[model samples]
Structures are given as C-alpha cells and as structure tokens.
Target: MGRYTMKSVSLNRLPIGSGLPKICIPIVAHTQEEVMKTAVQVVRSPADLVEWRLDFFDSLSPETVLETATELRQMLHGLPLLATFRSHREGGQQQTDDSAGIRIYHCLMDRQLAEAVDLELSQPADIRRSILSLARQTDTKVVMSYHDFRRTPSQKTIEGILGKMAAEQADIAKIAVMPQTPADVLRLLSATVSARSRLNIPVVTMAMGPLGKLSRISGSLTGSAITFGILDHASAPGQIEAGLLKNFLDELTVDQ
Candidate 1:
C-alpha cells in the first residue's frame, strides 16, 4: 500500500512489500515445552509470519537450538519462520559471543529451518558479510537490523542507518528505536517514509514504548513491509496483540 520504489521477497509465496504490511508474531520462551505452547497460539493468531527469539531460549547450543527449531517448524504448519538471535545490547534477553551466534545461524540456514534470518548491522562488517554469503548460498532471506533502545536519532541518522543496511545487501532492513517524546515518533515515521521511498529493498522501522505505539500500526502509510505483533509475550515494547493489530492494519488499509 506504500507508494515506494521497492522489491518484494517471497516467504512461502507471501510477497512482502507488495501490498498490505505483513503481521509477524514473536515467540519468546525459555523451554521447548513453553516454546511449543506459544507456537500453538501463534498458529491460531492472525500472523503472516513468526519470529523465534533464540536469545530467550535457555539453551543456545547448536544441537538443542536446531532440534527445537525443527520441532517449531512442524508445529507452525508451514507458517514462515524468522530466526533471530538478538544480542543483549539490542534488547535481547541473552548475551552470546559473535562466533557462537554465527554458528547457530549457519545451522539454521544450512538446514533451511527458517525462511528468514535477522543479523544485527552493529556486528562487525566481516562477520555480517560472511553471514550474508551463507544466506545467499542457502537461499535464505537476510534482514539486517539495528536497534536503539534509548532515543530516536535524528531523521537523517535513521535514514543513514537504513541506507547502510541496503548497502550491506540485506533482503530487508529494520530499525527499532525508543522515542522520548511524540515528536520523536514523528521523526521515526518521517525517516521510514524517506527510506521506504529511496531504498530498493523493503524497510521496517518503529519507535518503541507507549509514546511510539502509533508507528507500529502506521506501516501502510510509512512504507514498512512488516509489523511485529505479540502472541504470548512482546519481544519489543508497545506491541499489541496479533488479532487486534491485524484489525488495525485491515482498517487502515481499507481507509487508504
């Protein structure tokens, strides 16, 4: 619905960035049992995709993670899965070394456990490139992301970050920042609109916290290809329930 020059990526035949923004739900649980339970709920929710916050897992071992992911893949009944290992610095629950995290990513992509993977842009350039290479070889979509939990940067800064992600050859670019004021939320949306118009790849941007909740449901107008919604728990601040968020997106799309 966004009036932007962009390319769309297919996840199980669902074309992101081609029409209404797709809704994604996050599954954050510590144990496999809890994870499966959450997955069941996500399957019933009005979500176009599901993101597994690997950092929330009690075990980060490659074998355990792969086994768990395999089970989750089957549980979703073909829902697109996005594997994310958010660093603690990026508001993730767990802290992991870059080497170990990359290993886990390799496992996921090699086996095609997830359709898309999120790599932090803040990671070393070489590390990111290596992951991008593997992702390409495995036909996995790479979503390069950056997060600022403190404050929303100037619109120029936000746009620059998104540009960097595109230059990195990301299939998708995402940024999440905390807004200290209503004006900060506007700054975030302004940046999203600019990046969405200029970038060839899809972009996802949002301002976190109560003051920034409006941006979550404003993707259609701002050119964001995807919006994160909550299923059992919210991985980020200001995430509304998946069903409610779907209703909001539908209404907004209709009005537009």
Candidate 2:
C-alpha cells in the first residue's frame, strides 16, 4: 500500500489506488481479428484493466471505433475498458485532427462504451473542458494524461501538471515521461508521491523506457494507482509482460 491516503475509483468492482497497483494492458492491434485474439490472451493474463489504443487501428471512423469498443467490452468479460486515442505529438502511432478526435470521444461517451476515457492534458482548454463535461454527464471516468517523450520535467513541474488535472475534476491524473537519467526517474516518482498526498484523485505515473522500469514496478509504494503492462504487444516502451508484472506487484505488496 502507499503511504498516502487517497480516494479510490471502482472499475467493475475492482478498487484502483486502494492497495496494490493494478496492471492495464493496451490492445494495439490493427485488425479486428488481431484485437480479438489479443483480448483473449489478456483475459487469461493477470491484468486488471484493458486500454484500447485507437490510433493503432487502421480504420478509426466513429462507426468503426464504436463497433470495436462494443465488441471489446463483451470480449473483455467485465474487465474495465480504457479508451485512448493518443495524438501523434505524444508518441502515438498516427496523427489525427483535434476536431475528429473530439468527435470520436463524444461518440464513445454518448454510447457508453468505455468505462474510462483518456484525454490529453495538452489539448486546448476549451476542448478539454468540453470532453470533461461530457464525461461527467455520462458518468464516465476521465483519465487526464500527459506524456513527455523527450524527457522528464522537474519534480515541481510534474506536480503542477497533476494539480492542474485534479483541478479539471478528472477521476485519475496520469503522467508518463521519458527518463534520461536515474534522477529523472526519481523526480517522476517524487511528483507522484507529492500529488497523491495533496490531491484527492488517483495518480498514475510512470517513467517510460528501460531506464525507468523500476518506477513502473515500484508505483504501488510511491502512490501511483495504475501501471501499463504488455499483453500480446506493447503500446509503449518499457512495459513488462502482464504475468511477470503482476507477480512483481504481488511480491512487493506482500512484502509491505
């Protein structure tokens, strides 16, 4: 368990940010068959949640997005689904116009397909506010996220971003930064601890790539509620296999 007492979010009766950090596996397949196959593997794994990275799909129309989401919901067998359309600027597979991306998000919210949706903190204020409002109205959880592929910022700057996400009324505040040095990873973890102590919402923080794998596994001790793991394929760098990641988390939690 973490040192700080923070509010928790329930996903299909699973409590995130309460005890051990939950693993979220991203389904980054290009075709429906591939997605289905990977989801089957994820259901058998120890992952706690599934994140659908829509940008990896070859077709991303509102119709197709909804169709895929609906199928995945059924296929996941009650697992929490996190819908993510990462923008190209933030290390996504493809580039999509802001307007089109917002439209797809609205469709997901209105249809009530995903239990949670990821909205980038770098989006325009108006756009972010609009999506947040829709999420509230639909009773969908918003995972407000920030990604810095270049390098991790100072601890204060990372904490400031988490504060802003909390101010936006997001259910979860997530920050994933690339770390160049050991100190950078430490800064990310420090920010996570600080934010969780001060903010009411759950914080999901990770230091991406090989240099920061330690941060991913130690999140439960530092106040991060969730961590991404690789299922069939990896959507981001430095993700451990789901089974291995779960064992690591279990061991750490038991030791604590």
Candidate 3:
C-alpha cells in the first residue's frame, strides 16, 4: 500500500515508479462474448492493466459478473486487474442502489476478483473504512478516487481529499474533474503538482472534457501515477488512444 511517506508497494508484484508503460483499459461490455473480445484486444495491444467496469455490463447480473471475473482472470493470466463499479455521481451506470452497490463491491473484494479496486471518495467514511480494511486483508490495492463533473476545487480542498486518502492508506490517489475554462484546468494541474510534491502517494490526476483534455496526456509530466488511454476502447467521453498516447509520451519524455 502507498503511504504519506515514499515506500515501495508492489501491484501484483509489478514494481512501479520505474518509468515503465502502465496502461489501464476500461471494459465496457456486458455478456461473456464482449468481455472475451476485450480480453483478446488487451493481449494484442499494449495495455498493461485491465479494468473491468462492472457497471458497464448491460445484462450485468451478479452471477454473470462472478463468472466473467473468473474467466477474465484465466484470460488475463498475470496482468493486473481493476474492478470498479462506479456510482452515477462519478460518471457510471445509475442502475444500482447504495446498499446493493456496497454489497456487490464487498462481494468482488471477498472473492479476490481483482488485483486492484476503485472506490469513490464521496462515500461515507465508515463504508470507506470497511472496504479499505477488507482490501488490506486480501492484500488488494485500493485506488481511492474523486471525480468532479461540475468544477475543479482549489488546491487546498484537493489536498484535503488526497490527505484523507493518505490517512486511509490508499494505494493510489486518483482525481478527475470537469473543467469549464483554461484556468480551471490549471487549478486542477496545480493541485496535482502540490499533492504530488508534498503527499506521499502515487497520484493520478486528469481533467475530463475538451477543455480539460490536456491533463489526460500530461499526467506523468505533473507527477501523476497513471495516464489513461484507450488501448482498445474508450471509457470516458474524451480519451486518447494507446498508440497515440505512447507517441505523445515519447516525444514529451523529459529525461531528468
């Protein structure tokens, strides 16, 4: 797990901070057929990690989700897995209730279904505590996240949320916000820079939509732990593809 102090924590034994290409592709399918298709795409592409967006599955049933997890595990083999059931507040399916949502999440964690899991920051502290605590028991890395669809907050508020994650022992601090203007984007990036420099956790910061798209590819430049890309398919509204992102990162690579 990442702490408020720089200490190495392995993700499925994959040593991070080595300037390696770590890709996280979102799975936006329902049936086993589509899931398998995405799995094949990952094998053929440069994706370093597979994130099963559980909420995206159309015919998404609990049993089917479990079976798909098992199958995907076999297909993915050693690659790290990320299971996320993002709530409606954070740009995801609004089909599930809070109780059901919490239950399903715990179920996935209990099954040891993935190497990592994504949990929203807006959730109650008791719920967050329970989930993270349970993840620790399974040695599952937790990516505590926050997404702002309205506007970006000041660096102080950003730091406050990230600090809470640090206190909660989050493996990764991921924050995405919607930007209305150029200044909004800067605010988000500035906040990222501060959190990256002071906080002792790997930070993944991005600004969504066209106005905030710059941060998506420039994450690594500003101390972001991960930069998202569409390895095979797009998860969010505005996302660059993996091949294009690799080229972008290569040209922008600054040798310190």
Candidate 4:
C-alpha cells in the first residue's frame, strides 16, 4: 500500500500521532484499594494515558469490573483511561473466555467508563464488529491489538498484523512482541515505521524484553504513536519508568 498521511487518534483531547509519542502507564493491581493507590501515583506521574489491566484484578465479574472502572475513571480526573482485558493467550495475567470478556467491555462502554477500550484482533469477526459498533455509539475509541510473547515475527508478518487492525476500522492499532535476538527488535521497529507510514490510523508497536528496551524508547523515531511505561510496576517486559521514558522521548524528539 502507498504511504498515507498519518492521522492522529484523540483520547480525551490528547492527539496521539501528531507529536512525540505519548507515555502510557499500566495499573496492574489485584484489589480496588491497590488500583486506586496506583492510579493516584500515575496521576502525579508523567504518564499521558493510563491502562487498567483488568486481567490482573482478582475478580472478572462484570459488576466488580464496572464498579472499579467507574471509580478509577473518576480518580483519573482527565487522564485518559484505556481499559484492557488482556487474554492469557496474549500475555494477560489471567484466563478468560471471549463471551465474558465481551460482556465486560459492553458494561464499560454502556456507562462510558473509559475513554478507550482494547479489543483483541484475535477475536472472531462478528465479535469484533459488535464491539466496534458499540464503541461508536458510546463515542469511545477502539484499540485493536495483537500480541506475541514468544518471539517477534518477521517484519512482513508484523506489518500484516497491523494491516489487519486497520482493516477492522480500529481507531488505533497496537502490537507487542517478544524479541529472542537483537535483530528481532529491529524487525519490530522496521515494521512499525512501515505501518505508521501507510496506515491512516495511529500505530503503537513495541518489542518486549531487555533487548527490546530500544523499541520502547525509540517510538518517536519508529513512528509508534504511544509507548507503555511503568509507574509502580511494569505491565510488560522492558517497559522503562514513565518519568525516565518521558525524558528519553523528549531527548530523541525531533523539532518539527
């Protein structure tokens, strides 16, 4: 596909693709109190967005998830929240069926609890379409994502996965892969550049692990619109602290 002009995805008024990549910190707590405490710290940190990893919570019940998400949304004030139920197959902390996961997503959207919600690209087409349909009704952004914790795929494969996300009409496309070798990291970055250049929607890509640290901090150069960082803890491998990641991004950002 020919390269297209990059279109920024807005989350709570924040433009994702037009400037230096934004830093998003994950809240991976087991209890409501823990979730609140970490949120407080994230609010005071340099994070531009917060992701609540629902898989880490002890309970996956819709009621529990809804109540907690509602409170976390309020606590964040204006900081954008990206609700994610990372499936175990995709590096999530817990195991969950697709139907349950869909239910949770619907509840969050019904109340407009989050500014954005993650819908895994691995789900069936009908399921993904339903979620995207409701996201439009709720005015919520859909982050269609794919993750491979085993090994980074070939650059072509990486780009193809991102292409699928764009095909689904995702507001944002995200992919995370683990690197078994330094060259693997490069492949992820290379694919990110290609995806960013061709896709109209914003792209978020990362190579996870110590060797993948470069991909996390090199978003500005690779065309990744957002990078995940840690506040109290790391949600994914190789995530730099939010403060440090922000500094690194600032240093690397080119003056437009």
What lDDT tens digits, residue by residue, belong to model 2 across residues 1-256? 4344459988778787787888999999998888889889989989899999888888878888888788889999999999898998888888767776778889999999988989999999999999999998998899999999899999999999999999999999999999999999988888887888899999999999999999889976788999999966788889998889988988776323
Candidate 3 on 112-153: residue-level lDDT in tens? 888888888888989898989999998889889998888888
Candidates' C-alpha lDDT: 0.89, 0.88, 0.76, 0.89
How many clashes in each candidate?
A: 0, 0, 1, 0
| Better by TM-score, candidate 4 or 3 | 4
Better of 3 and 4 by lDDT: 4
Candidate 2 yields a Cα-based lDDT of 0.88
Model with the higher TM-score, candidate 1 or 3 = 1
Provide the global lDDT of candidate 3 against the true structure.
0.76
The candidate scoring highest on lDDT is 1
Using all chains and alpha carbons, the TM-scores for the candidates as numbered come to 0.96, 0.96, 0.91, 0.95
Supply the TM-score for candidate 3: 0.91
Residue 216 Cα positional deviation in candidate 4, in Å, after optimal superposition:
0.6
- lDDT for each residue of candidate 4 in 9-107, tens digit (9 for 90 to 100): 889998888778899999999999999999899889998999999888998888889889888988998999999988888888876677877888899
Q: Give one digit per residue, the lDDT tens place, for model 1 in 1-256.
A: 3344358888878788768889999999999999999998988899899999888889888889999999999999989999999988898886667776788999999999999999999999899999999999999999999999999999999999999999989999999999998999999999998898888899998888889889999988888889999976899999988999999988887323
Pairs that collide in candidate 1 are none
